[model samples]
Target chain A: MECLSDVGFSGATVGVVAKRAGVSRGAAQHHFRTREDLLTAALLHMSENRLAELRRRAADLPDGAARTGAVVEMLIDAYTGPEFSAALQLWAAAANDPRLRSQVIPLEEHVGREAHRAAVDLLGADETAPGVREAVQATLDLARGLGLASLLTDDEPRRRRVVGQWTRMLEETLR
Target chain B: MECLSDVGFSGATVGVVAKRAGVSRGAAQHHFRTREDLLTAALLHMSENRLAELRRRAADLPDGAARTGAVVEMLIDAYTGPEFSAALQLWAAAANDPRLRSQVIPLEEHVGREAHRAAVDLLGADETAPGVREAVQATLDLARGLGLASLLTDDEPRRRRVVGQWTRMLEETLR
Candidate 1:
């Protein structure tokens, strides 16, 4: 994961990952045959880690108005971390690689659905209500866009303001 | 741009681009000294095309309540096209390449600010009002996130639904 985040997909070769893991190339290959296999396994592991992190953060969220802010912040944090960075590398690679895209698309959908469910639960949103489900999805999308912005620059101050504003908007819409 | 969109940044070599453009390699290099120069030029072209496209669509938008949905659709359209696909390739490449990162970051910021300003103008939104500016920013972010989702799969159905929901929210917020 660190290899993917630090050097990107193309640069994270088997030998490099193996060396970084303090294992011989042959030993690494013994476990995961191809780079695709290794990457798929790593991404699956990262997805689980992200969900676990979301659940852990959900436990500490405060009640009422404060919960919206915390939930938005937590969601934003999920997208801005190294895990997202690694996933982004793989996503870019997969965009042009049909085989990798085939493997990645399902995993991404599963993770996305899980994240959306987690957000809906954390916000105590009733999806049966008109626009509530889309509001939650929009919140997640906004977080991801903020993450994309953060990839190139330190967009923290603007991001904080945006989050604050979205939290307010979400509070009203979800209500 | 098509080359980048179709094959990604690494595969869109000078040779491939030249071949696609029906220009000699010498002529291509004469215009762009390096791959970075070629990509930078292409990106600038793409950005201008996007903004011009936005303005053209903006002129056709309706008045009053219906405008919000049209604006949301316009913004979403801005991000889901070939220009965005080419830009995504560059963004992923720039994330790991410092030199490319420096060039792409400023260009992206400029484009983002332009898009935000355009959205504010189109929505007739008041930035002086509390949360208005952030609302606009979040709208753009949501559009971008929708774009990201479209990259891997045919997310049109869900994207349309989310846009519909967001249009309602924006109409309420801006009102």
Candidate 2:
């Protein structure tokens, strides 16, 4: 994951990743036959880690109005940092690579669904209600867009204000 | 632009782009000193085209309630298709390449602010009102996130639903 985030997909070759992990190239090859295998495993590992982190944070979320704000914050945090960076690299590469696209699409769909389910739970949102599901999706999408903005620069000040606004909007929608 | 969208950053070398453009490599190099120059120019060209298209669409938008929905649809349209796909490739490459990052950041900032301003204008939104600016920003962000989603799958059905929900939210917020 670090390899992908730091050097990007083009640079994260098996030899480089193996060296980064302090493992021999042959040993890395023994575990994963191709670069695709290695990359998919890395992304999967990162996704699981992200879900685990979200669950961990949810356990400690405050109740009531504060919970909505906390949930928005958690979702934004989920889309930033090294893990998201790695995923972005893969996503960009996968956009043009057929084999990588096939691997990434399903993984992304699973992660996206899981994240949506988690958000629904964290926000105490009832999806059956009109506009409820789309509202939750909008919130997730906004978080992702904010993450993309942060990749180029320190978008925190603007991002914070946006998050504050979104939290209020989400609270109203869920209510 | 097509090269970037079709083949990605690594594949859209000057030689390849020139070939696609039916120009000699030397002629391409004469116009753009490096691949970075060519890409920046392409992105700039695309941005200008997008902004012009937005203005053209804005001129025809209906008055009152329907205008908000039209504006939201326009915003979502701005973030999808080949132009956005090419930009995505550059953005991903720029994330790790400082030279490209320096160029892309300012360009993106310019494009983002212009899009935001355009949205504010089209919706007749009052940014001075509390949360109004952030609401506009969120709308743009959601459009961008939806664009990312569509890169891998046909997300139009869900995207349309989200846009519908957002149009309502935006209408209320602007009110």
Candidate 3:
């Protein structure tokens, strides 16, 4: 993440990360078999961290709606927060690199499934409510896109407004 | 895009892009006053290309539903198309780099509005149709998330299937 701050994704290098971590090339290799492995590890580590944090943030909330709201807030925070920029870097790499995709996709799917389940459970949505399901899926989709778009600019007020819009959508859907 | 392909956005330099473009550094500077300017030009160029193709793809559809569905399909194609990955590299750069964000955000918003408006016009959706508007926005949002998620894997069939699911949702929503 530190290295990403200076050079961004296209500029980040394994050598630079290794040097920054104060580990030798061989040591880094032992931990990550390849450059893709190294990046995947770093990304997964961050995802796990953020996921855990999201759960923690939502823990105190009452039910699925509140939990969903909490999760939406978490998404907004994750995107605009300090840890977000590195994710942007990882995404950039994954966009074109097939090798990186192998490592990154499963994690995302896992996260997507988890988030979807949370939304489903929270709304008491049944298998038959395809419309609700679509809405939930769409909410997740828009949040991700908006998150990336938000990073393109540092508009705090806009970010806040977007988050509010997201929250409103969730509420309206559930109601 | 060439620079992104060659260097994957990690180590690409303005000097390198100029060299690859077969232009003198001064000449490159003359066209793009800064690296960000070059990136902005590249993004705009690609967005235009993608939008034009989308317009053509959706033009032949028989009705509003079909047109909307076509737009979703076009979105999937535009996003997963070869140009998209390259654009993503710069997008990632912009997400983390404030200097780059200034250029990236406006372009994103422009393209987003274009897509949304197309969907609205095709659906004949008015502001009062919160459900329809939300549905349109939701589908676009999910397609984005899925597209980004799809980039991390080599499952072409599954990616298409996932996009197909989204297209299906649009059909159902319109119905």
Q: In model 2, what is the error at residue A70, expressed in angstroms?
A: 0.6
Q: Which stretches of candidate 3 lie over 4 Å from their true place?
A: A10-39, A64-80, A94-139, A154-175, B10-30, B33-35, B131-135, B155-175
Evaluating just chain A, the predictions reach TM-scores of 0.95, 0.97, 0.80
Highest lDDT against the true fold, candidate: 2
DockQ of each: 0.75, 0.77, 0.35
Q: Residues B1-175, candidate 1, lDDT per residue (tens digit)? A: 8998899888999999999999999999999998888988899887778778878878888999999899889889888867777888888888888988888888888888888888998888988987888888988988878888888888898999989988887787888
lDDT of 1: 0.87
Which residue pairs of candidate 3 clash? A10-B9, A10-B10, A10-B11, A11-B10, A64-A122, A101-B152, A141-B141
CA displacement after TM-score superposition, residue B112 of candidate 3 (Å):
3.5
Global local distance difference test of model 3? 0.65
The TM-score measured for candidate 2 stands at 0.98
* Local distance difference test values of all predictions, in order: 0.87, 0.90, 0.65
Q: Candidate 3 at A88: error in angstroms?
A: 2.3
Q: Between the candidate structures 1 and 2, which one is better when assessed by DockQ?
A: 2
| All candidates in order of TM-score, best leading | 2, 1, 3
Interface RMSD, one decimal, each candidate: 1.0, 0.8, 3.9
Instruction: For residues A17-71, write the lDDT of model 1, one tens digit per residue.
Output: 9999999999999999999889888988887887788888788889998998998
Tens digits of per-residue lDDT, candidate 3, B30-149, equal 888988888678778877776776667555666755665566766666666456667777777766577777777787888888877766665555646445566666556555665665
Of 2 and 3, the candidate ranking higher by TM-score: 2
